[model samples]
Target chain A: MTLEIVSPGLSTTIQDLGRPGYFHLGIPEGGAMDRLSLRAANLLVGNPEDAACLEAVFMGPEIRFGADMVVAVAGATMPMTLDGAAVDGWTSFEVKKGQTLKFGFLTEGARLYIAVAGGIDTPPDLGSRATYPIGALGGIEGRAVAAGDVLPVGQGTGKAGRTVAPELRRMPGRPAELRVLPGLYWHRITEAAQESFFADEWTVAAEADRMGYRFKGGRPLEFVEREQPFGAGADPSNIVDGCYSYGSIQVPGGTEPIVLHRDAVSGGGYFTLGAVISADMDLIGQLQPNTPVRFVRVDMEEALAARRDQVAMLDKIRGALA
Target chain B: MAEIQAPVPGTFYHRPAPDQDPYKAAGDAVAAGETIGLVEVMKTFIEVKAEAAGTFKGYVADNESPVTAGAVLAEIDA
Candidate 1:
């Protein structure tokens, strides 16, 4: 079976859980921004949680299914329609052969997932079907799907009518609060600047995408008056090129703060103030441009506890779906 | 009556560029799918298109002002 692209939506790409253990080679673990939604879409269609699915931003693709299949969409709040008839999201539904899927203007959030029963059968690059467009790896031709492109699908059976509970579905908060753990470079800036970072409300900028999110409207961070270290640039925000963990919050030139996401570069010259906890990283993806946000500081213990809660929540979802 | 809504949220631009003329002006004939303006979201500019052939009424949103999804940017007499 195959899926034919009618009109590829704005920035639609195939993504799975992503390929880990490759960031050391400068390849980010590129995958779905809202992973929970991806997983929910997959499970609702009887596919594995890591199955490859379409991740569309702002809009959704117009697709004509080549064969009968089951599908589900999750994440964001765009209304889905099949063959001009309305269909519910976060619930699995059947699509007859030759039926087309489309979406209306997004009502909320920034990205959404469309999971087919057997998952996309594209050849895996680096053992992953996830697309890393920057590195030209994985997905169909390592790029976003274009008009007239046919995507092969693996064989599998899925039962329709499965739905993820509303309470179980993850959504970003109003003025989302991202918990951060201050890093080793925290001392580079004045304590007052650090306090301002958490106190001042920052808004997501127009520069947000899969790689990272840029936040503005916060107090400009002031670096301590110290001589630049060897190999570091005169800009106080510049460091001696250190490794960047996923979710690292790098404020270049102490200006707008940027939170690196799944597709982040492994290392950079900018000093990182800290990272958004893994538990809260998914929320970053759903944040819309100009959305107000606040940085909440957390200790290692709190971060771990948050992560554990996230895992437990996933377990609850699996149980509910099963 | 026809409305051209912003497909996504961002800063609405009435002109193609800061110094250029607006994509459409009041009373101008707008063809279906004709570019009306642009919405700059995530550092990318997406053209807002008129959905029906008509005479352009005027922009509803101000130039370079923030707009939300589905907010009407321009109106047209279909």
Candidate 2:
């Protein structure tokens, strides 16, 4: 079976958990920024959590299914319809051949996840179907899906389940309190700045993307001259080009904070003052432009526990699917 | 003298292929924007392009060495 892309949205690409352990090769771990939503959609369709899904940013494309298939939509709550009939978000539904799927305005969040049973069939590079747009690797031709692009769907046993409950659907929109952990350079900032980081509210700046989401917050942080030195024996500069892991909080020029996402560069020169706990990255992905956000510090042990809890929850959902 | 640092943190490679000559050696005339080395991260090899045009001086870090962000990989005589 196959799906024909009628209208590729702002940015639509195939993604999975991501390609890991190759940072030393200069490849960023490109994948779904909001992995939780992706997993949820996959589970709804009885697919593996890491199955390739369509990640639509800002808007989504119109697609025509080639055969009867089960599909689920998650992540951003965009207005979507199948054959001009309104469909529920975050639930699995069977679509027959020749039915057209159309996505409308984004009601909540910045991106959407569309998972189909059997997953999106594309050549795996470095053991991942996720697309790295900057380097042009993975996914279909290692690029964003475009109009007229025909995506192949792998063969499945044709066994599928029912839809998810409406209440179980992810709450659309960004959350207020954002959890973070101290990073390598957390001590570089003065205690006053650190306090302000948690005290003052920040807004998602216009310069937000998969690479990093810049935030406009309180007064710019000022660091000692020696703390901003470069080269050997010098403190790493607060500005450089590189993709950081999801949740990395950068304090460039000791001013605004930028939260790095999945498609972030492998490394950079910026001083990472903090990192949003991995469990909280899904909330970061849902942040809307100009949305106010506050950072809440948490200990490493707490972060670890939260991560475990998240993994367990995903496992429970998967077990239910079986 | 200015140094050419790794654009991104990764393993610094002197040559593209093993058993191949280094892209540039000490005292070689190199121009700006010339790729002097490469950094491999996540199975992706990114070429490190020289920002300043000058004579290639020496490498600060050895081949196949793990380097972090801003780590100077090579020096050039400007």
Candidate 3:
């Protein structure tokens, strides 16, 4: 019926598929960073695919449930325990009233998802319960869950013990590669810099979060010389402040590249070199600081194919559980 | 002999900020849950807290150096 937070983790918030159709109003979609994982967690607990779940980053919370409930954890590998007993992730399990859940150190990935049967019963704002802390929209009062805050839970419809197996999903790569679709503002950057964009190995910067991930460890890219246009900033990387697609890469000051995510700003003036393919956003969401990354260019056909493959993977998970 | 590990990987900071004194020095008594350092990633600096009461051992990872998950950051004489 309710969950009591004994300790709030680093950054735990409620998220779902997010609210689209509002980007024109300067509101980000602001869903779970890794939607696939959110879906997987919901599936394990028999909740609807978009049922809002808790997105815990780095550290996870210590939670006590007020009633018996089914639960599942997916995405990052933060060791979890149910009343001191080890709890396996990617698998569903049940807990009795007054039982507590704790998370240990993270051995892999950046964000972790915890899904309860039914869902986190919070009122929606603009059709979503996903939190965008920057604007104080959605989630519990539009912020991360705090200690002693009681969260309501809906009724559970699924059983426990089933697992989500997406081939354990991209945890072992030393320098993960993100497949990219280039040419958003490709003509704006010099040919040499564009080459390096795909060839050079970039490191995830410490400034990364749900809004965007900035990468370092590469030379500042040079943009092609052009007369400054009206309303565009004086910087060469500036544009006319255009729409930013989710996963779009924008370089400001041409110093570092940022890939927007679920909580992406609707429009920006910076020049975008490319976008991480839709299928590859999950991999980007898992990047940790100092993690090496390389961008590989792909055509639109390949991008669509990759997305289809991901959908097939979800169907695969559903079949295995069934 | 127990050592404090980095819960998550990032650049390990020995002090709260660049100008502040180091949170702990070797031989200092450390209390449980006391923050001794921070691991900064993606603009978020997560405090590294002492897990048990012990005599602090000097940092293992150099200040501002990149650390991997589970990598020893400092030692504690329990």
Candidate 4:
């Protein structure tokens, strides 16, 4: 079956769980900003958790199904309509042959997922179908979906009408408390700056996209006074180019702090203060501009616990749906 | 009466920018797709447009107030 894109929303691209082993080769594991929702959507349609789905940003897309199919939408509280009538998201629903699906303005969250029961049949790059637009890797030729694009859909095995619990869905609001695991070059920053990093309410800047989120409204951080080592740039914020962990928060010129996300550069010269916990990285993506964020320091144990909780939550969703 | 609802949720601004005048006020005329305001989310200002042509009514949402998706933004008398 084919899904015809009528109006491609902002940055609508295909994504999945991403490739894990290729990071050492400088390939970013560019995938869904919200894995919980992506996996949930996939499970709703009886697709594998890593099944490729559409990642719609800011707005959603208008697609006309060429054949009957089941689909689910999760993440972001946008108005979903089938043939111009409203339909609830986060549930598996059926679409008749030649019927169109459209989305209203995004009310909450930054990215939303649209998962067809059979998964999106896109050419995989680096062992993944997730789109890394910067490097031109994976998903619809490594770019966002454009109008007039005809996407091939796989035959679905799941039945329609599978709905997730209301409480299970993520609701967007202010002041997300993201957990951070302080490490890497955390000691390079003065203690005062580290304190401020956790203490102040930082606003996500407009420059934020899939690559990273730049935080404003905080005290500009300062590096400890020291002579620059050879091969390290002259700027105090610069270090010898080192590998970056996913969700690494770095400061450039000691100005606004930026948290790298999926599709982020693998390594850079900027000194990273710490990495945000993997479980909370999706929350960073959901935050609206001007949304308040406070970084909470967590131990590795706490971080792992949080990840376990998320996994268990997903399992719970599968149980509920089953 | 035609009520215009917010398509997306964020902080609603009556003007395009802080220093600019609002697109419409009470008693102003508006056409469909006319930009009436902007919703600031993650620093992206998405234009809130007039859904249909009508005589503009004052906004139900306060200026610079946080709003959710599907919240009624303003009304219009066609």
For candidate 1, give the docking quality class from DockQ: high
lDDT of 2 by residue, B1-78 (tens): 998876444468999889899999889998889999997643457788888899999889999876654578999999
Error of 3 at B9 (Å): 2.8
Candidate models: Cα lDDT each: 0.91, 0.78, 0.88, 0.85
In terms of DockQ, which candidate is stronger, 1 or 2? Answer: 1
| Native-referenced Cα lDDT, model 4 | 0.85
Classified by CAPRI criteria, candidate 4 counts as acceptable
lDDT of 1 by residue, A196-265 (tens): 9999999999999999999999999999888888999888899999999999999998999999998889
TM-score of chain B of each: 0.97, 0.95, 0.96, 0.93
* Position B38, candidate 2: lDDT: 90
Task: Compare candidates 2 and 4 on DockQ and give the better one.
Answer: 4
Choose 1 or 4, whichever is better by TM-score: 1
Global Cα RMSD, each model: 0.9, 15.8, 1.6, 3.2
What DockQ, on C-alphas, does every prediction get?
0.82, 0.01, 0.73, 0.32
Q: TM per model?
A: 0.98, 0.75, 0.96, 0.87
Give me the runs in candidate 4 sitting further than 4 Å from their true place: A170-173, B1-49, B53-78
Q: Which segments of model 2 are wrong by more than 4 Å?
A: A158-161, A165-175, A225-245, B1-78
Please tell me which model should have the higher DockQ, number 3 or number 4.
Answer: 3
Alpha-carbon shift of residue A1 in model 1 (angstroms): 0.8
lDDT (Cα, tens digit) per residue for candidate 3, span B38-62: 9987677888988899999889999
Clashes of each: 1, 16, 5, 7
TM-score for predicted model 3 compared with the true structure: 0.96
Candidate 1, residues B36-57: lDDT per residue as tens digits?
A: 8999887799999888999999
The single-chain TM-score for chain B of candidate 2 is 0.95
